[model samples]
Target: MPSQKLSTLEKVGFGAGDMALNVVISSMMLLITFFYTDIYGLKTTDLALLFVLVKVVGAIADLVMGQLTDRYTSKGGRYRPYLLWLAVPYGISVFFVFTTPDWQYSAKLIWAYSTYILMTVMTAGVGIPYISLVSALTNDPKERLSANGYRLFFAKIGAFMVTIIVPILAQKWGDGNPAVGYQAAMAVMAAMGIGLFLFCNFTTTERVVHVVEKQSLLAQLKVLLRNDQWLILCGVCVTGTVGYVVRGSVAIYYAKYYLGGDTETVAAFLSTGVIAAILSMVASTWITKFYCKVKLFRYTQIAVAAISAVIYFTVKPGDMALAFILYFLLSFVVDLHAPVFWSAIAETIDYGQVKTGKRVSGFAFGGISVCQKAGMAVAGGLVGILLSYFNYQPNLEQTQFALTGIALMFSVIPGFFHLVMGMLMFKYRISDDYYTEVKVQMRDSGYIAG
Candidate 1:
């Protein structure tokens, strides 16, 4: 049997994968919409279309990559090899997306679609495998949770770097051209992404191997459809992602327009939330040791909804101090569920296998990825539509209508989705105790080593 506990190096190595992924994930969530309109000169409507279409392609790519992982194995194991082979291509794709050409609107739109699609496909190639690595790393649920805590902490560190460094780099490097600055900044981020992926590939090992059965896609889908617990988790993923993406996509806009901040204020505002989220990862790991993770997941999200309502009502435009304080609180509370949620996905796969008499590992993770993309599509389209409806013109002094829309998007709108996410968790029955029971059954049945 493989060892259950991982060393700090492996944990940090595993986390570095997420930190790499956030080069694109964080940018898509936090900067893409702003980049497209304010920097790349796309209309809100075009931006909306681009976001939805790109994620649609990404969703399909996720499933394909999942199947590839299931079918292929190498000396490095099932998932880690992808990090080594594709890291350079992934970095190159990210760089190209930020590269704005001096072309007409029609040609530029085509460039946008091509580069964004390429980036999304590369993201799927690495992302699916990276997330699935947790299962192969260990059978112990506690260790998975701990590793995920490190993963999320580093993931937030990536976001912190983006919020703090990207703006400064862009401003200083662009000299007078914001577009040139953004391109240069993102190129640096992309190179860091390549290095992190290589580090993750070299330092991590897949020890707990599952014998993934060869099955047709349709057969796997049927088995997955029967997993009620997995289904519930999928629902939770969608709602939670919608909340995260919507709020995240609007944050820079919120700081710039509603809060009336310049580049410095925007960076500070975004950094506040990310720093709070980083603390949430640490606090969550410690809290789950004493508190029930499930109850914590459910309650914290509900509390976030209340906090969101408070922020919307209490903080007026230009209330920077109050906005920062409330935003920090909301960011911290909302993410308390993240590590629990990710670790739960692997548990759900085990639950499904024991219940359905088959193991569907890759596709299960892929399905979750698909759900995430769906949420992003919804959130992206919504942000574009709302901005257009609010008559938001880029880099312009805001109208009252535009300011209110930004505030609502940043707080109440996303809060409602999070409230729904918390309610959905009520249906998720997996707990540490319950998962222990699952392991006992799997062990006795000879599916895994005890």
Candidate 2:
């Protein structure tokens, strides 16, 4: 990819797509627990198990889609086809997942497996490839950062809005029936999902088209594993994701029980994170220009971990004001990593090609997606097991230990992952100079003008 800039129109569309993506994804993440237990009428343990299963299955689909994406090309190019193929179906499935009929737990689980699995396959297949397309879109390390950062900045805004809106919609709708609220919420979000995927597909075109190769399955896997930078960075991303999934998973609990609020209050707190994320990422554009990305990530991670630890100990049952304040600070630091890490992934595509003389951005990110799904899977199982062990009861008073346990999950788990991510990132070798060399050598568009 070269240093060419996306057009102003394309940029607007891309940013909108990013915003809608996060809005839907975060709304799901932020609300699914309550949805499962209350609206779907599934047991908490069953709900958690379902969450884990869907993520793991989706992770597997990500690998297949990634490989196919790298191997398959068309007039539309390597990745854009997925944006079209999966967009509508993905939205439909999301709606179904959110608003299944009230039935026996067994029947509900079956529907859960069916639509959730299908949705995961289509969405992950499309998403991993679509995200990887950024590598081929622009090779300017800075441009890549700006595009992804700008995208995330707006995405966080959408997430903030959805966080505020979804619960209210759920409440207003649930007054009639909780499932109906869930159904309405999903329908609205699905519309957004379908629209965004379509817009992103048409707005941006692919560059740096790879010569499609007929290679054995094993060969593709081998190529990806051989890329040293991808291996390390993907590993770090997985660990960080463990932290993220855990935090997101437990944040609901933290807000509701530890703070003694309802789900609506939890949504309000998450909205705070969403709001802070926008400002932080927008501010990061200046920081990215002056400061090294790895260094910024390191400082941010340490600060997040340290502050989280403090908040965990200091947050009292009544200190809602202080808790919100501390959480907002953590939110700012934590959101900073989204743009930095994703922008870094774009760089890894260049580094891998430079070192191996082969560009398999999809394959590289397939492995990347594995870490993400793995984190969710492990956290889901552990959370289920933890909830079961702690005697977590819905529609009743939660145990003190369970509340404390959930708080630790948010603070300690991500804290540890951040520590590991900080260490792994120190080894990332692609600097601005290295990226320039890679584009020049390949005759890619992002080669900075001399």
Candidate 3:
């Protein structure tokens, strides 16, 4: 069996990986839509197509990367090597995604597609292995949960940087050119991401190595499909991600237009949300110590839906203080599920191994990744379509219809998804006690090596 304890350093290192990954993730969630419209000048319809196609490509890449991880291992371990191998390319891809070329409109669209696809591919290159690393690091469910708390806490720190730093830096750097500012600012974040990945690789060690059975892709899928709990988590990933991306993608617009904010106010508003999420990480870690994580996950999301409705109905346009307060509360409760959700992935994988007698590690993680991407795809398309429907115009004073649409995207529409997410968790039954039983079974079955 894998060691149940991880040192603080190692936990921080593991956390750093997500922090690094969040450079891309947070940007995708928070800024990509805005950047495409305002900075890079892509039409909303073009953006819709691009988001859908790129995520489709990303889902495929996730699957391919999954298989590759299963087939490959080295002295640095199965998953950590990817951090070393792909760090530079990953950084470069992030830079390219934000780069604006002064080309023809069609050329710009092509560049957008090319760079975005490249970024997603590179993201899979590191992301699949990075997530799979959590299982490799420990077999203890509680340890996994604690480590995930660290991971998410740092992830939000990365997101906080994106929300607080990116806009400010872009505004300063671009100096009259927002595109140049975004490019320069993102280059710095990309570099930090590369460094953080390397730190994660160096500081963390994989102790729990699964004796994964060599199987065909179809066979692996069959095995994964049999895990009902895994399926539930898949649903959770999709719906939660859709809720997250939809709200996040619209936050800047909400802040700038609905709240009538300038650049600083916009940054503060987005920062408020990220800071609340950051605090939620700590709160979740502490709260789960005293309560049922599964229950917490279910209730917090439902609360999010309720609070979101309050925001929609109660907060009027330009009601900045009330908006910030409600949004902070909404953001806080909405993310309380994060640590539980990520840690539960490994638990479900363990449950799957115990149930199916087949250890489907890499592909299972990949499947979760794919679900997240699918959610992003759906959310991105929704944002684009909704923007078009509402006649959203970039850098222009929005029509009342468009402003209301932005408000709904930020609050009610995404909140409905969170409601679905919470209800789906009623089907998830993997408690800490149940996971302990799973561990005992795996140990007895000799599926896990001591």
Candidate 4:
């Protein structure tokens, strides 16, 4: 049997893949809606359509990539070769998504759809493989958890960089034209993504190779349908992601308008949340060693809902200091579930295999990705609709009503979704002890190498 342990270098290498992937992930979460409205010259109503349509394309692409990973193999292994082949394409896609061409409004809208859809496809091309790569890396649950800790930490670092550097770079380089500035800044970020993916490709190895039984698309869906734990996770993923994306999408606007922040303050505010998330990754990993991870996941989200309510009621307009402290607290508590949630995916797969007497690897991970996209779609649509409903105007002083709407989106609305997320987790029954029992059965049955 392959050793369950992973080297520190291997852990860092694995983490780099998420760092690279976050170039697009963080952008979509933090910058894309704002970019379309303020920089790229798209209407809020149109932005809703663009986000939903693009994610629909992304969902189809994820399913296709999942099937490809299951059927194709190379010397680099099933999942890693995509990192080598798709890195450049993915980086280029990121650049194009941020690029703003000088064109008529209608033509520019077409460009937005085309480029965003293309980026979504390219994102799935590598994203499904990178996420699925975790299953191939090691079978040890603890090792997977540790590696995910590293992965999420670095992922936040990527987000941290985006929040801090993109605004500053756009301001410095745009020469008063934000379109040109965003393009130039994201190009630098894109190049870094390519290099990081290459580093991840070179340093990581696939050690736990599961025998993926051939199944038709319909058959695999049936297998996943039977997985109750996975279904719960899919539900948690959607609700949790909706909350996350909503808050993230509104944060820039909240910082700039509601908090009355300048460019530096905006960057600082965004970075503070990411900084909290980075620390949450570390704290989660440490706390899981003593506390029950499932409990931690359940409670922290509930705590986030409470914090969100607090921030909404207490932090008034232009209350920068109070807003920052509460936002930091909210961000920190909200993300405590991340590492646990990611590691739980692999365990759910194992549980599925044991229950169904078959393994569905790539498609399972892809399904989770689909859930994430679905959440983004829902959140994105809500954001656009709510912004329009609230009469939000880009780069302008807003009405009292509009500012209140933005505040609700940032705190109360997303907080409600997170409360649902935490409540749903009450149904997830897989503890570490239960997963060990599942693994032992797999080994005795010869489903995996012993």
Best by lDDT: 3
| Regions of candidate 2 where Cα sits further than 4 Å from its true position | 444-450
C-alpha positional error of residue 422 in candidate 1 after TM-score superposition, expressed in Å? 0.1
Per-model root-mean-square deviation over C-alphas: 1.0, 2.7, 0.8, 0.8
- Please give the CA lDDT of all the candidate structures: 0.94, 0.74, 0.95, 0.93
- Model 3 vs truth, CA RMSD: 0.8
The window of 10 residues in a row where model 2 has the poorest summed lDDT is: 441-450
The whole-model C-alpha lDDT of candidate 1 against the native structure comes to: 0.94
Q: Candidate 4: which pairs clash?
A: none
Q: Count clashing residue pairs in model 1.
A: 0
* Candidate 4: stretches off by over 4 Å: 1-3
lDDT of 4: 0.93
lDDT of 4 by residue, 1-450 (tens): 444898999999999999999999999999988999988878999999888888899899999999999888899999999999999999999999898989999999998898898889999999999999988899888899999999999999999999999999999999999899999999999999999899999999998878889999999999999999999999999999999999999999999999999999999999999999999999999999998999999999999999999999999999999999999999999999999999999999999999999899889999999999999999999999999999999999999999999999999999999999999999998988998899888887788852
RMSD of 1: 1.0
TM-score of each: 0.99, 0.93, 0.99, 0.99
As for lDDT, the candidate ahead, 2 or 3, is 3
Which residue pairs in model 1 clash with each other?
none
Count the clashes in each prediction.
0, 5, 3, 0
Candidate 3 lDDT score at position 432: 93
